[model samples]
Target: MTAPIYVPFQHCDALRTLAVPYGCGIDTVGVDPASAAPAGIPEPTLTPGRYLQEIRSAIRAMRALHDLLPPTA
Candidate 1:
């Protein structure tokens, strides 16, 4: 058995063409919370309710930003 290969998200498009022939799988990673801390800034602590509220607020902001972008093909 072979282990899966980790390919960067940006390079996945190129790898797609070779993945099947090589009989290997490619995976991409998402956010690494351990490294998400801002430089020179301390992380904040939040209760469960506050955490959920913050997450919801972020989603709303992202949706608003996405709506501002022009339509694409």
Candidate 2:
């Protein structure tokens, strides 16, 4: 895990880490789902790390393209 980055506006003390199924993004990472259920928000399956490779590839491509593009005014 990467070192925690500080965001001044965030309440770090209030953050809670909940375990979700592997590869599934946690909807209740910070807030409990039971509290949110009353709002009618249906939890959806979130794919964690599925598109990560593609994202890293895209970023690398962008960095490569940056060197190829001529400098702008």
What is each predicted model's overall lDDT from 0 to 1? 0.47, 0.37
Which residue pairs show collisions in model 1? none
Instruction: Give the poorly placed runs of model 1, Cα more than 4 Å off.
Output: 1-45
Tell me the tens digit of each residue's lDDT in model 2 across 1-73. 1111212112221121112113334321345444555577765433456346445644555565455556999
Using lDDT as the measure, the top candidate is: 1
Tens-digit lDDT track for model 1 on 1-73?
1111212322343244445346566554544433665687664554688657656655655565456556899
| Deviation of model 2 at 5, angstroms | 28
Worst 10 residues of 1 by lDDT: 1-10
Clashing pairs in 2: none
